[model samples]
Target: MEIIVAKSAGFCFGVDNAVKKVYQLLDTNNERIFTFGPVIHNDQVVNYLKRKGVKIVNDIDEVNEKGHIVIRAHGVTPVIYKKIKDKGLILEDATCPYVKKIHNLVEQKSSEGYRIIIVGDKNHPEVIGINGWCNDNAYIVNSADDVEKLKKSDEKICVVAQTTITKEKWHEVNEALKEKFENILKFDTICSATTKRQSEVEEISKVVDLMIIMGDKKSSNTQKLCDISRKHCPLTFKVETSLDLPQIDVEKIKKIGISAGASTPDWVIEEVIRKMSELNNQEVTKNEVNQEDFNFADALEESFVRIRPGEIIKGKVIGFNANEVYVDLGYKADGIIPLEEYTDIPDFQIEKEVKVGDEIEVFVQQINDGEGNVRLSKKQVDINKAWEDVEKAYNDKTPLKAVVVEVVNGGVVASYRGVRIFVPGSQLSDRYVKDLKDFLKRTIEVRLIDFNQKRRKLVGSARVILEERKEKASKEIWETIEVGKTYNGVVKSLTDFGAFVDIGGVDGLIHVSELSWSRVNHPSEVLKVGDTVEVHVLEFDKDKKKISLGYRKEEDNPWVKVGQMYKEGVIVTVKVLRMTPFGAFVEVIEGVDGLVHISQISNKRITKVEDVLEVGMKVDAKIIEMDLENKKINLSIKEVKPIDPPDNNAKETGENKEEPEITEHKEEMEVTLADVIKTSEEVKS
Candidate 1:
């Protein structure tokens, strides 16, 4: 049988590091070694450590002797760390870095008033540990159905996944949460190594006659691999070691595929491969297999080939410190990426960005850095790909997001995926940018307007993107604009005559006369730049690209309630506004005025109305004639009766005094043709 082994099989970076830590503790120290739990899920590896005098305890209190305690890769909660410290035990933290990142994320988000949701099996140790970080308040869900049971809430939600869960499970739960919650943050925290292993099994199982999954049954990642394989290949068998291999019909199986979980050790995989090869060889000789079958039998014995220098390959991040990050390239020597080689960005924090079990593409710099390590450069790979992406964006006329990193002499420099592009001051915005420093560290969208790959020069214009969006918005506004329709707009600028408001992309003017029912001398009296106001489309000319907007509301018009508020013969206190040649104008209410003629100024004849009613005087007047259509009211002060006051001497004597009764009467005057014509002209005025 032809045996095809999956490339991403066997122990991942985290599991390997954890197991190695246990051995190192055993070899160097005489103190009793205790693990918080089984260091790994593989039974063979755990048993081997137990035989070597390593003790396993579920809790810190279970440790009877003072010794070194190693926290397993599946990290424990803060309570465990406190217990270890209180017991005075030497703590060796073997928690996977990627899992630790989730702990920090949950703790921060929970403190910030976000409800934490973990997408994984709640019973799993990793999920339980993560819950502890959030004060054991996280909602653990494994599928879409579990999300349905949660109560809908407006609280901001933060969703994180267990490091070993399948990508499909994470995606399914996230999609369900999106439908239920309006504000949610989803972090796909599934380990890259787990994803790679699951994907490889799916691909291999499709064409193979028999698929063999190797790992402990208790391992979550292992069970997931078996589940994925069974869907494509029914002849899938899961085994822990070579001794547990199931009986297979070697003659019938022409091709067999092999894949292992992250917890499975390399020795176990090699042993299984050796046993399968022996079985295939025996069947071939007995059946007198053809030359092609013999060649397939020999293929099982071949080992992994060595990688050459300067080759680009995928590696899993195993561990990292301040100086460098270590990667496993499926080779003997681990790859080392120095800080400078990892990224060009100066403020890059390795601990926050690089995590264990993450897959990264690296360019091999050297086979040996004189320290028996493979030197790798991740920045080199990124730089090479960034140029290609930049060229594509330039050719396709696609916009890219970039952050302004520096302000130079004539322009600003923006960094796009570590590639610097110069944006001239003129291209920074459609309007003049007085200070380029304002764009510093701010993210802006830009399209490449010019570039030269050979010269390593590029130019981008944020103005181009702004203009394009403005043009599209202008078109949409003109298509749907209707006269007298109201819109919410923001005041863009102010002038003496009007205020210009941006309803969408188009700017419409609100004349000072239309700003309010009350007179407005300047647009600034009613609106300032950036003030939001509701305006109606009074008139518009599409060809001129001009619009006239009205800001005064019909409901706010003072004349709307005049008919209900006033009528003829009603008494009112009026304020004299100004004196006209024919009459004195008084304000009845805001924006409404009444005219009092000289003839009706008082009971006695008056030559001038201003003589009795000067400007700014408050006087009681009776409304005689009202014309609602013309918005005019005629008031007569002489028609209103005055109240007489009692003498103070009568009160001092305690004598009852009679009060004088007041009566309203009109004064008759001689009439003339010129007088009648002049009165008529005064009423009209």
Candidate 2:
């Protein structure tokens, strides 16, 4: 029989590190050594350690004396660490780095109001440790059915996987979760080492007649490997060591494959290989596989092109999920680009951008990214090309489009082709930016003002682009501007004197008097900053770079309605505005005041206008004459009939009586000649 040994059949990096730490502690320290649990899943290793005076304690309370406590590769919860400190035990942490990352992720996500979902065996020690980080409130789902049983909710859900679980299981559980939750965050936390070992076993089992899966029965990853092997080859046997090797028919089995779990020791694999070689009646070395019946496919698989880190390669898109895309790199292992490595655009949609059978170029980040998949980065390639273009644009004085991603202390951070460009607050616009957050998620054109290639620093200015456009527009406006020609403009600012409006990049002043036909106390009464208004150019001084704009339309002038609104012998109600020595200036309408001479104050004789009429008093009057040319009106209060006073008896008895309503005819008017006469009389006095 020919033997094919899986290359990835031994202790993985994390398991090796943990076991080595235990042995090193055993030899260097004279004090008693204790492990939080069995150092690994293998029974032989644990028994051997026990023989060497290493005590295995399931709980912290079980340790009666002080000693060096080594945490196992399967890690412990935060409470366990606290207990170790309380008991004054020296901790030699051996938790896997990848597992520690999961702890941190769950803790942070849970604090951010995400419901944590762990896709793995609930009883597993690793899952338990991860659950502890999220306050032990995580939903542990082992299969799609478990996920289906969960009620659908709008709460954001963050999904993570046990390091040893299969990728298929992780994906399956995630797919089920997507059906129930709209906002689900998935982190494929499966250990890369476990993936490689499982993948190797699946490939070997396909060609082998008999397969031997070696690892402890309690090992979850080992059991998964056995299941994969059994599905491919019916004559699959699981064994803990050489002693457990099952009886095999040598005549029927031409090729036999051997694989081991991540926690299995190298010595155990070698011993098993030795037993298999003896059965084949041949001497075999660890590195040499029987080549008598080796096929061309196996040779070609081993001779596939070698890949190196930092090298650019072309690949065909084979598959994709929300978090990552898989590409066939024409090598033994396919490449995977995580979502973060694809693009920096916040709204980047992978499905919309990528498709199967599409060929693309990628930068190799790692030849083997723990999970036996080549780690690739499309963003790095884009950023590399983008920086070259950015530098060229900076030297050529060209503008580039960028999306704002964050608002920082001094400026906003914008992303252009995955590269971050800092646009300072002063550079955001020509006008002051009151709130920087308004620019977040907005795309704007920017010019590169500063570039530091060595330090990877890039500073951009949107204001520069704006200024250039405005300069061009100002030139055009100056060449084509015409008096009385209307143009749409945006109000830039408001002041007591006037409003500055931007009409096609040229700022023109709109005096407060020109804002409306009626009198205005301030420009803000008619126009505010950012209001769009139709303004006509009243006049301009080319040398002074000043343009006066008119906002009030002629149709809106109050005097335009005077000829149609009022005529001679018209009855009206007027409000007394102020008292002059000769008469009281009474307002007929807004911006139109008529004088009521002291002689016309009432039918009864009065010495002064103030004797019968006080300021702000309303009275009935008739327009006896109108000077439309000079915009004046002569009013006489004596021409209109007045109502008699109420009886004193009725007033004392509190009798309610309905008074006739005075109808006041209102009309728009401009400054009347009455104001000129009143000013001259006041000056003489």
Candidate 3:
């Protein structure tokens, strides 16, 4: 006969804390001591406290005046706290630390611009307190699907669990809530005490004959322990006290295991164990307990020492078998680990976090019960720890080390803190990097920018590093650069009027005509994006941040040659560039132009000059004059060619019908008396 009890089979820190708080009030205080609610979910403990002169009060108004009012371990709302304080009653504050943390989280995150979500039963007191702290902005939800009612926001949100929430279901709720919110902060907040109790019961339930579970029926976590045990052995039964159990069939039972709820007393666990121990000595011809039933013993025969499945033990690999490795988990059974778990070369003689004889955490996945062996998963433990780290990174805004797995535009993909973080194209380096892949497989430090716990999305920024590098480069470049010096630069951009050259970190313009000694119609005709050319800096407008530059300084000025081509009143044919209201600059020769005004274009009465001439038209023009002082030219298009008149000298050979065209006129005005007298006097002379 064998009896095995879990090391952590009974009530934990929180339940003990609450139980002690109520007992102190009952022992020392004289007033009608009353707890606002049950001190814990356990009715057995609550009823025990009631028997000790403690009364449970459902309403604040029901409390007697000046009574010693004890707030239950589940915690009370600030509204209720204030109301009780206002009543002038003596108060006992006994809220558990785990529950109190949720209250504080609600207050802090709500103040810092996050809406609170409470994951648990709405009727629970802890969640009610959590809701009150946020001015009722907290929404209550029970299951995974219940999160659908929440309105979406780009704003940050805080999620917390009720202290007694089941570990696995809490995961479901957390995963579900995180899916809808872009910015979600999840605080597991499930009391550590609750986790210990659950894990203990889950592990203990495996090898027990008939198990006795001690807990109050109303206790949620206690009921959870009972449910976990029944999956292993259906004979396990729940009993609040010894009164609930019948006389045991000691003759048939040999190995019996006993576990308790978190609220169950230590004395209670001891009493149950004592009653079962006497059963092992009965006259029952039971099957013997086999130490070799655990799979770890079977793997050792093959000299492979790794933990077998379904056995929780620590181990270090000392040697290997043909198909497995050996780990010595300091138990009676040498552990056997499958070789498949070791993917790479055995990482020994290095900075190993674990090694042979080094203790490590692993999950018992299965028991090779047939071969007296077990299968354990080290990878599962690593993944579990990884999720915890990823959650911590999401909470703390920490920078993590990662390898750049792939290069993408503007950034790289790096696995940081066990999450695939996206480095955007803008963040690949400290400066502008046109090629991102060069950084692939290279280790880098990255800060997480965008992350989600539910979707497991993480985004990083290498651009921040790139920007920092850019600033440093700019400082160095600026230190040596002067306002008027000349440097070689690449033409980075071209426009209709000029080209923009990248002179170190600065950009300067090169006017189209200044590009060469001859004509330049457009900047693109001579320059391209990467063309390296030398230029002289003419002016640096510090206020405007504009740099005026000149090209073609190595050659003679094109305008100097123009002075020789044009002269005043020199008629020269030219091509029209553009027509303005005042005049048009006509290219009489390459790079030499003269202006032809609208008035000089034609001899006829002109209403609109555009009606007669169009741009890009090559026509004859006469340079009537040039103004060298003003760099202006005057031109004439009308004088280029003169139209000849019709000839009148041809002999008239056909019809005489035109004979009446002109009449001979006499009697011109008053050749009056004065004229007649003058004519007669001249004749007499």
Candidate 4:
């Protein structure tokens, strides 16, 4: 007998991904592993997992320990996700991407004020999950009769299908809804694998004497496959395992066909094919038997591509279109990469960027039997290489430079050799940077600070490189810096007491007291930020790297020439600088000041210095006492008053110019009295 097996059978992408996720968790995680539900409807796989220590948890509350909770391939409601997250449980979502798309589509449509209508079994987990996205406002209908029950309404409506629903059922439900609503948005959310499997069943069942459908009894897709086969061929049997195979009359059956559901495993289907082959006769005519095509197990195995998830494989570009590129992976089925999974390059032209016969490396995203293509990702391969390069740089502590491409929240994104890296706002500068966007479009050197290959993360810091450079320069500066050496410095900052200057590599303090020979109240009065000034190191602590700088040139001090410029009894013009309680301080030179005692001003008795002297007033004074050691000069303004000269008219009148002589004698008497007053004032202490 000739045996024909459907190509699109056994473990569709979604179920396979879910099962593999559990196996992966079992291999890596030490914590007790649990699946949110029976990972699949298959009893064999579930029992196998039970033997392997994987517990099946029906409800989230059944889990009392801290571990991971994997959402099954059928997906879960938003409330279940919330409960898992609220309980602080690690969640591994293995929801088929197609189901995720349906959830998103329904959510978007409902948010736009359309009444969502789901055409599928309401109790199905996939339908329930999609309904949850729309806040359960979706009208679930399984048949055209269910749509006939829907009340007539003017509200706009959107409809989507269950991933396992047949194309004919979707069209029938849509036609029923169209009769009731004028504005209806319909989306075929059915998984492509389901469509291909149903179609294969129909094609293989025609002209076959008997048909075998494989999968669990509870599997909706498997039941659909069986129904499709039964319509084309009357003698059909649905079996969950080899033991469930019906009693067959080997002599009567000339041609047999096989098909399975999306959830059926390959091994289960292989066992059924083996059982059927054992029941068949080995010898038959070529026209009646077609012996070359009777090996159903090997044919199914060959058709089921030998590929593992996440495997990197090499392939040649075979074809391209606007949304996908096709590659020949040297397997039964060609590989296809969607435009979204190809590259991150902006406005990428796949036609120009890739050509037929060009060999390319791809990451196997999923074994998608739905589309009859192996879903591959070029971007994932590039991202993997990018992460490796970033990890190497982080481990080696090497510098990496990249051009900032985009600015995002909390940081700016940069790309190095096609890998994106994040530089946090704080790490953008050695000092605080308020606007991270300022670095955009600029090339910056950064040190890789952190990396995670699993999460596909790369963190970089420009501040680390800047800090290292500063530290190195500081060490060099400390080793060379010495007291009594002059260096050019830039004013880095200023305070009330000092100006900080950067001399080559390190900052030193130029105290306000050392800014100039004259008194200064604030450093800003004589120095400002970024001003270059010559400074000499006065003191330094190498261990602390603290250097004290002197900005005023010693020879520039006006007091240095005090001995030559002024002496005791020397007369000079002085300005009253300030009034004190006991005396008036006067400036005799730019940097030199003398104190005029209250009693020395006008030779008058004064209660306060302000009573006899006004500030900023110029007057003549005699330097009475010079304390060179202490840089103090005492002056007497009253003693500097000119004595009256003899009158010329009195000399002409010969008026005994004795009056003029008497005047001169009176001046001498006044001088003598001033000395006596000074002596008395000095002795008052």
Candidate 5:
């Protein structure tokens, strides 16, 4: 059997970065410095860093400035940053650059208007850092389907990934979010280190009959490597030592491939090899050659790095055509990239920008297309370059300058750095941008969120300026409302019970009964659209945010000075303001009215009130009685009567009466509306 070994097999850029940060602190700072986490998932690197003076701390309370406190490469939550800041302790951020990107994505996306979904283990330090940065709540989903948490919004959603997660898993989760939201902002934050290792494992499994993968159990990227490799060859086993090898058919196994994770040192891979060589009677001893100095030049010579679908590459423009371009890579052949690859490159006049023989760079997308042409990409190349610039932009805390490219639901699409970032309706301006059309092609500043380079999704905010102004507006209006003082208020809304008026930032209610001085059939009768009227604050409960507002305050009490207006048995002119079954309502003054009882309409054989007068008709009536305390007025319309009956019904009724009658009866009543109104004023006093 032929032996095959894979290339691109060990520590990635982030892991290397994390490991170096921890060990470097040991050389200068003797003061006890603590890693906010274990530094990186690699136990070997962590153990080495610990010997060099780096220590692990799990909580804020556990941290103090003995010398310095370092945030680990996995990153820490913003909550952690605030706690450290509050303690007045020194903080040294050792978080990997990729992890910091996730933090900024959560912070900006959550602040504007996006439901943040982190597709990673919630227990992981990187994901925890991401969730902590968000102002709006963010949830973590570890697998393809996690129902306990889902996005809740009518607006679009944003999705991000952990830097260590595999590209394939990220894609699966991204597609799932697309099922729910009409538009999804997905950021593929999966680091290049993770995909490279997974691809190496996949190739190794197909060639080898038996595989030994060495890694720590807690290493996420290591676990993914085993998972990817297992699909092609089921005979693979993950172990930290030679002791984990099960009862395999050792006699039948000939060709074996051995690889180690980032956390597994080269010495460990040698130990496993030494044990395997012993079984096959091959003398590969630790004494002859040091495994630490093992050469990988042979592996490199045989291997040609391949970029799978969804992998990102950074390159530059070299040459161009109407349909395609040629890029000079250090690869075996110059890469041929299609024009479609530059979908996001703006205003492309390819030949004007690029010329032949220009040293251009690009992503090695595919080893070969069916036509013997190696497929390459410029867009993916730009994203990788953009990430480097974006990281700088975040560190400076500067606003992203961009232009609106398209109008999407609940937001506008703005292009920055050859990538489109979503600007929510609430983030399009300091206040809502009423005319989004006006924003088209207009340049503005934005703070981004939910950014994941792997998924290519981002959300941004511009409304922090708006909310500050809103608070100022609210404060100015609150000072004007006063209880028991009438002022002009405009009606805002109508209901069966009341009308709500916008006095300022708050609202006040005018009960239907308080709408008019008289009994109103409906409040609409006295108030119309845009009516300006005086009102009084009857009650105010600031704690409850409620107010009892009153209208018609201009009409004062009618009984202010009752004794001077009317006396018993006075005659007056009045107009019938309204009619009731028991009496006719008559107004004799501007603010006063009285009732003329039916019995007081006439003293003769009169059966009906319409015979003398109808509503709105003026008449003379006598004030037969008065009640100042109760505000009642008694008047009569028929004080003068004929001395005898004119018809048979009256002729029959008159035989029972003695005739002091007609003159006394008609003269006893008859008063005018004006007299009754004045009398009501007198009685009310």
Candidate 6:
């Protein structure tokens, strides 16, 4: 029997590191050693540690002795860490680096005002640890439906995954988050080693007659390996040791495969391999059928083509269904690409994208021995090509075309082929973009601003594209632009100080002071995005590409009518707009104002302008002076015409001349002006 061992079978890097930390701790100190949980999932390893006097405590309170405490590979929450510290226990943190990284990410994102969402089992220790980093405020979800059940929030969301989760599941949950939220941040925290091991087991299981999966039954990753293998090979067995292997027909099984989970030790796997070899040898001697069977096996081997895992090959599309696509690999083995192995296209339509006789590159995932078929992945091939293209673009300073799939926190997601590129909100446009959702489903050209293959991160900038185009357009505009020339433009954005208008391809700033004929506090009061307006070029510099625009018409200045309409000593009702220590400025109309000096504020001595005037208070004033060239006006509140005195001759004649209109006007003016001054004095005292 040919025994094929998976390359990734054995303890992964994280598990190996954790196991080594325990042994290293044992060698250093004679004091009692304790772990917060089982050092690993395997019972044999835990028992072996127990023999070394290592105690496993679920809670820190269980430990009475002051000694060394080692955290398990699956880390504990922040509260546990603080408790350990409070007890003054010697801490030998054995948390897997990958899991620790996820903790840090969630903490940092949460502290940055982002609502944290952890996509993993809520009960899992790793997820619990991650949630603790964010004060347990994180939304823990295991499936896409959980995302839908979440309460809608406009708060920026940051999503992270458990290190052991499958990439497919991670993508599914994040995709759902995209649909439910307009501003989401996603981090693919699934460990690369976990993915490779699962993929290797899936590949090896298809090509073997019988598959043996080794790890403890309680190990979650081990159970996942068994599930993946059983789907491809019917003769699949999960065992923790050599003793657990079931009786097998060694003569019937010509090929066997072996794979182990991340927690399984190397010695256990070696023992299982030794036992299988011994069983096969004993069967050969007892049956005495090896010579005849060898000839049959040789003939069978010659009829089928041999393919290794991760081999890049060419294939022709033959047939397909909803779940899988059939391909002819030009060998005896027929190839098929499963739905998970296809490129990640949005709302992917297999029937339309794939057709018969279409040649495509595929990465060989598995080669079946019994059925003489292979498992292939077009997605893997495409991923490799995309990485190469991304690297090239980064080096060449070239722009790439992509579709904006979703708007996320701090960015938008633009995809090319199957690769997702992050474009920050600040990078989405040359001007500030308030609504990122406006770019969704639109094709955008972007330049790579940051690329890290090791971290599997790519950042693009659409602002770079916008800036490049604006630079060219600005150059052309400066060549012909002149002062006093009016250009029809659209409002691109607004700010407290100004409005940026897009004239052709260039942007010009219309200062808030020039937005209208009246006083304006913000640009939004008179202008908004996409509003078409005519603006005159006030100033421009070709070298700086700075264009200042004026939207207020020259003929619309209200000060021009000050001298013609109102002269000195003219009584008018004015509203107080603002006050200074020396005087008060009152608006005569919507766009016109006059200053009332402290000395002229009242018939009584005015110690302060506010003593007689309150903002928005209306009072009658006489225009004392007007300088139209300087656009300044002076007014006197005390100089208003007085009410006529009651007729004394009528009173002497007993003519009943009360003069109610004249007396009432005098009383009203005195009371109105006196109440304001009295109120101000009352507030001060």
> Which model scores highest in TM-score?
2
Count of clashes, each model = 0, 2, 31, 1, 39, 0
What is the TM-score (0 to 1) of candidate 1?
0.44
lDDT winner between 2 and 5, please give it.
2
For model 4, residues 233-306, the per-residue Cα lDDT tens digits are 99998877776677777779888888887777777776677787778644311212112221333443354337
C-alpha displacement of 316 in model 6, angstroms? 61
Q: Looking at model 2, which ten-residue stretch has the lowest summed lDDT?
A: 659-668
For lDDT, candidate 1 versus 5, the one ahead is: 1
lDDT winner, 2 or 6:
2
Task: Estimate every model's Cα lDDT from 0 to 1.
Answer: 0.83, 0.84, 0.67, 0.81, 0.67, 0.80
Write model 5 residue lDDT over 1-685, tens digit each, in one string: 2334445455555655665555566666667777676666644444445445565666767755565677866787767889888877678887778878888877788777888888888877778778888852776777667723465446757788888788887877777666666767888888776676677778778877887777765677778878887898888888765545445455677667666676565555665666776675654312222234324324322443445555554433434558888553433333578876754444567767655435455666676564334588766766677777666665665578777778888888987756678888878765345777778877777776556767767777666534455567556645655678665667866887878875544568899988866677777877774576677789887677788888865435455444477777777788988877676888855556878877777555545555555778887777777786887777776763312223443343555454456656656555455678889999999
The Cα error of candidate 2 at residue 23, in Å, is 56
lDDT of 2 by residue, 1-685 (tens): 8888987787888888899898888779889899987789875676566557787777798888988999988888999999999999999999999899999999999999999999999988999999999999999999999988999999999999999888889888888988899999889999888898889889889998999988875688899999899989998888877767777778888889998998887777777888988986854423532222212234434545788999998987756778998776767566899999988787778878987657888999998665456899999999989999999988998999999999999999999998899999999998889999999999989999899999999999999889889999999999999899889999999988999999988999999999887889998888788899999999999999999999998876666666578888999888999998887888887867788777775655455565566678898998888886787788888779642223431233323322211111111122445677789999999
List model 3 lDDT by residue over 1-685, tens digit each.
5666666656666666677777777667687887786777654455445446676676677775678887767787788888888888788888877788888888999999897888888866677877888998887889877887766677788888888777887888878877778888888898876777677667667876777788765567677788888888778878765545545666666566667777666655555665666655433222222121212223323443345455545655543445565444443233455644432222222224334334666567664423333455665565556667766765786656677766665566776433467888776664466677767777777767777878877787756654565567555545665656788888988999999987766678988877876778899888898899988877776556677888886436545666676566666667778877775667766755677777777665444556566777777766677665676677787788632222332225444334334222233334466698999999999
Model 4: which residue pairs collide?
193-370
Better of 3 and 6 by TM-score: 6
| Alpha-carbon TM-score of each model against the true structure | 0.44, 0.45, 0.40, 0.42, 0.40, 0.41
Q: Which segments of model 4 are wrong by more than 4 Å? A: 281-685
RMSD (CA, Å), each prediction? 21.6, 22.6, 26.4, 23.2, 26.5, 24.1
Cα error of candidate 3 at position 404, Å: 79
TM-score for candidate 4, residues paired by index: 0.42
The positional error of residue 299 in candidate 2, measured at the CA in angstroms, is: 17
lDDT of 2 at 619: 87
lDDT score for candidate 2 against the true structure: 0.84
Error of 6 at 216 (Å): 1.1
Residues 505-594, model 1: lDDT tens digits? 789999899999998888888788889999999999999999999999888888776667988999999999999877789999898888
